[model samples]
Target: MNSPLTIGVFDSGFGGLTVLRALLPLIPGARYLYLGDTARLPYGSKSRETIARYALSSGRFLLEQGAEHLVVACNTATALALEDLKADLPIPVTGVIAPGAAAAQAVGAAGHVLVLATTATVQSGAYTRALEARGLAATEKACPLLVPLVEEGWLEATPETIAVTAEVLRIYLAEAMAEAPQATSLLLGCTHYPLLKPLIEETLRRLDYPLRLIDSADATAQAVAGQIGTRAAVGVATSTAFYATDSIEKFQRLGSRFLGQVLPPVSLIDLGG
Candidate 1:
């Protein structure tokens, strides 16, 4: 490619910044347009029809901003509206679920695999279907507390907070491992989870559970790079423009944590419900 590609990434909130963080080093030449539908978040509690509608609205907004490809960064949106976005949008569309399962398979994850995700994602069973479709058995566990803990910066905070986070992870992993004793890999089913990878690995080590960790954010970035057929271009720095439906200040603060870098000015755009 002679010039950089324009890619659109959509998510319900700050978590999707992890996907963008993974994309930067992999495809350093691409221009990214990220939209966080902050106003109508918690898509988890919404109906499937509503989620598809919201996701389609976000995708269309990104397309209008000159996006050539779309990445559905939110697990809930990916599970519920991926097909809808693919059908309605003209450009290539990728979601978090398939790439994650494919990553597990790529790493020689055979037999059973354990998945840690949000309650809504677990209820949707998207990871299980994706893994099973790839001939790998999957057990999904919902760690509803993990997302909030990560968002609150409990990871590597005060000793008390970190200990609480670790204990929660230990409990979740203990139950998940007991359910899938044969699991050789553990898929991090939420974008927010990549931030907790070290702790997760530590907990696994403590439990003597040797499940390889798979981060969907990394997997999805690799998938996007493959779809575009280009990689990091030397001397070609990547650029990103951030947009959010509500709370630009908060998005900048929390999003910086997920992206591992300070965010630029976030333009506020209203996408009505």
Candidate 2:
């Protein structure tokens, strides 16, 4: 591995920016290439074949950009196409689910863990199986509404909107806790959920639950950094390139929230529908 590693992070949409955000601080000065397949997003609803097709295309594009390592930031892609990617690409490929599960295990929590993700991810049972592999039981809930709400910028901290988001969290958490009362850790299964971490913590606080929160994006980033094994900032500056399959303006606008900083002009990439 080089001092400034060239890593490619791919997601179906902007949610994966959180993973990149975590990576920026951990691997500063590293050149990063990110692709968001906005045109064929919601990989969750698509079939495994369609998802593998779309994800593999994105992975190949990143490799063409000279990426030495690939990070599949989308959980759906990790669930359905991770092996496909590793088999097709020569680079070391990593996905979010395994690292997320490993993080929960590292915390050494007793009882079960709760996973919150998209319907597709929950249906895939990837997180459930990963956690079970580490000797933990998990209950997964698909929080379908949270993704759209986060993209809509509904978390403006205004009383009304805040209440709405919190209420939604309350409802989801209440239901999830009821089904798995022994769950001591809450694994945020979606990359987008990191944006709602505060609200989720507050909601649980109000609910009188002391569940440990795990952000998959953070866990994935840590795993990637550990794989590279460089903590010291080595280079002068970090470089990043952004590509999106559709709606460059929307991706650039909303992506900043997940990236934790403003994004440079995004290149419009057409990965054929």
Candidate 3:
């Protein structure tokens, strides 16, 4: 393949932009198409069948836009619907969970590993399964509030928002620490969590929880780079496109926070219920 690659990234909402942000630096030569299924988000509340149906539709839509490779950036989708998408989507696909678990194993070295993710992702026990496969002991806590706070742009907002977010993290991490007393690493199992890494690390310090933080978004981007070697020409501009199933206005407004740059105009596309 002499030409640049076109990779499609899908998420339930804006959090996936963290994955795309990580990808830009690692694989900048390639074109990127990101779709956030905003209409039917919070996939954690849905059943497995519903998740698979929604994810399949998004994957097919990306392929329709000429995506040669795919990245499943949403933790809930990766936990519940990855296999379904893999079986049906022909492109080489990667997800955040496996790389995240592997990252834990590599860093934890048999020490207890703790994961902070969405309620649906934790319920699926995907991280537990992946970590255990590598002979690592794992504890997962569903900090359901983290995703919402991240999406709301509260991480760096006003004093009240900052304090509230910090308090929430303190509560979740404290509870998780009590359960996984020996846990030595904290995997930011949600893509959005990466944005709060500094706050999380500070909170861990305050609580004396000596766990290294690993952002799965970064891990996934590294995996993608390994699979698709650096191919950007020395001086060619990269192409990026954004789409959402609902609320294009919100996607563009909140998405800039995830992408670290003003998002290009995001087009609205329906993937159906």
Candidate 4:
């Protein structure tokens, strides 16, 4: 019998679990190997060379685990090191940026496409370039706090936590809208932001901002499905392996929030800083 298809996903931290969550339904019956380089995370603050080196290491580790294709699920890694990864890795590679921009373009987001991403991703201008390359105007907002709020399990834990997160979303949305009043699409450029989608929609409604939301995680999953085709659906059951460079307990604990399901046993691995 043929072996099950294996797809590898790499992220600086467990935020990429959101991408994996998006992939579960779209590309069922495939083995997933996910690596969260938690030890050396915050890839956003690192230099380009350092980020590329880290990404390549993570990609190669997944390939060694029998991954046939790789997904760079972190926006910072995708923005900084996707090209390097594609060039060095033998397997097909996908990132969260281009697919998102294409998704926005497909929805006829022509006048202005607002991007909500990490400060590093915004500084890289990756989303802006991708959107404009497709003839869509791009406006990127650096939402640095959203990641922490999501990671902290503040999405609706309590009235106080929910209010804090909602207020932050309200402030960010208000600021972003002030800059791109004509924005027709608001792209969630960070993987962690998917957890806040409902709240974001609600906040948008509260603020009377009607920009369509574009989730990069879902878009990337669809792109992966399109690339791998139906062969990925051959197996009877889908399996996933989780790995983290540091803090296996923390990875499993916080990762479930992003993945929207209980995570299985996670292995600890070291890739060296």
Candidate 5:
């Protein structure tokens, strides 16, 4: 019998749970190890160097856990450190950006696409370049606060969060629309941003902009399936294990919110080595 194929997934915080949620259903019968660096959450505000260092440590930790493949699920880490991590790691590694960019371009609409993500991701201009590479112009805005808001477990009908999200969306949408009236597609660039999608859609509705929201989670999952060549039969694990560098309680709490269910037993691991 073949050994079960295991995939390792890492994120700066709870955001990557969004990707894992989408992936598990798509590729059932696969073993997964998810690590959330909740201790050092919010890679968005950190410097490129710091983000890279943290991501490397997390990725290495996953590798040590016997991961056959690596998925960098955090947009900030994908933007700033994926390449370096890929080079350093022995297994095939993937990031969410390329799949997302490919999906956005496949829309093929001649309009500005807006990307909302972390400051680190936005500053890297990764999404902008990815879109433009496929001949689609993109406008990216960094919503550094939204992640924290989502982590706080505020998902619905919060006036304060809605107002803040609206304000941020307004700035980006206004700029994109002014530059091109055809701008109609908005990509949720960060994994965490999907949690706020309802509020964002409502806000856009008020602004009279009929925007199509694109989430890279599904696309990223498909990409992983392709990379791993899903023909390899793997054992179906009913419960996926979780690991965190920080508070397992916080990870479980935020992860459940993102995944829409309570996460299974999450163990704490020290990746500081």
Candidate 6:
């Protein structure tokens, strides 16, 4: 209903900041309402029904805050609850999986694409189906522990984290090799995975297989931009704001890790309201 438009970005925690960073630059004048459900984060391990309820509450809160559009930036939530939330919300809603899937298809076909996401996302098989729909082979692996490791700010070194990452990667690589010998691309299916790119790259190098990594944040940003149209002039206030279901301090601190800077002040809102 507004001219410049305010985009609502929802995440289980800090990960959505990655999506926000990409979308902000693309739509310069567009304001954004970033809602991080940090109090009840790590949606990856949650049940589908729980995730759907949380996502719906988050979307509804954004709508009440005057959001023009919604971006479900959490892969777990997107994988488990996007469709139901979209049906419940009045505004247009977009999720991260389709954009990532589409980007994987654009990279190439025939070669296998390995998807690294949370357990729930992998369990949903959204990436596999989306890629198969485009005639590409996809292999999905769930790195369930990665989310906690990331939330702890151990992107580089944590022996246990490193061990878990290595083991999970080894399994994915072995599976990919067995299924499709030509797999050359890896999709960072979860928004939080990009933060561990350096460690992941190191692991791949040690394995002697250099695979191209796709950041779903970039794809989802592009999708949001395309949906909202081109950028407008700077200084024109778009209706963007920030909201969180829990601690604003924790959200701001961790969010900077993803977005590369401290985000604008975030307001706390109880979605149950």
* Cα-based lDDT for every prediction: 0.91, 0.92, 0.90, 0.93, 0.82, 0.82
Residue 206 deviation, candidate 1, in Å? 0.7
Answer with 1 or 5, whichever has the higher TM-score: 1
**Candidate 5: where are CA atoms >4 Å away?**
157-181, 232-235
Q: Summarize candidate 2's per-residue lDDT along 1-273 as a digit string, tens digits.
A: 345678999999999999999998888878899999999988989999999999999999999999989999999999999999999999999999999999999998685899999999999999999999999999999999898889888887477887888888899999999999989999999999999999998899999999999999999999999997764336458899999999999999999878988999999988897
Cα lDDT tens digits, model 3, 1-273, are: 357789999999999999999899898778899999999998888999999999999999999999999999999999999999999988998999999888777775456789999888999999999988999888999998988888887888899999999999999999999899988888888988988999999999999887888889999998888898887755666889999999999999999988899998999998878
Q: Put the candidates in TM-score order, highest first.
A: 4, 3, 2, 1, 5, 6
**lDDT of prediction 6:** 0.82
Candidate 2, residue 260: how far the Cα is off, in Å: 1.4
Candidate 5 lowest-lDDT run of ten: 230-239
Per-candidate TM vs. native?
0.96, 0.96, 0.97, 0.97, 0.91, 0.89
Give per-residue CA lDDT, model 5, range 23-142, as digits (tens): 887767777899999888778888888989999999888899898899999998999999989889999999999999888877764556878777788899999999988888888777
lDDT of 1 at 13: 93
**Model 1 / residue 68 / CA error / Å:** 0.2
TM-score of 3: 0.97
Tens digit per residue, CA lDDT, model 4, 1-273 = 457789999999988998899898887789999999999978888998999999999999999999999999999999999999999999999999999999999889966899999999999999999998999999999999998888888887899999999999999999999998999899999998998999999999989998899999999999999999867545468899999999999999998888879999999998998
Candidate 1 lDDT over 5-118, as tens digits, reads 889999999889999998887777888999999999878778889999999999999999999999999999998889999999999999999999999999999878899998
Q: Report per-prediction Cα RMSD to one decimal.
A: 1.7, 1.7, 1.3, 1.1, 2.2, 2.8
Per-model clash counts, in order, read 0, 0, 0, 0, 0, 3
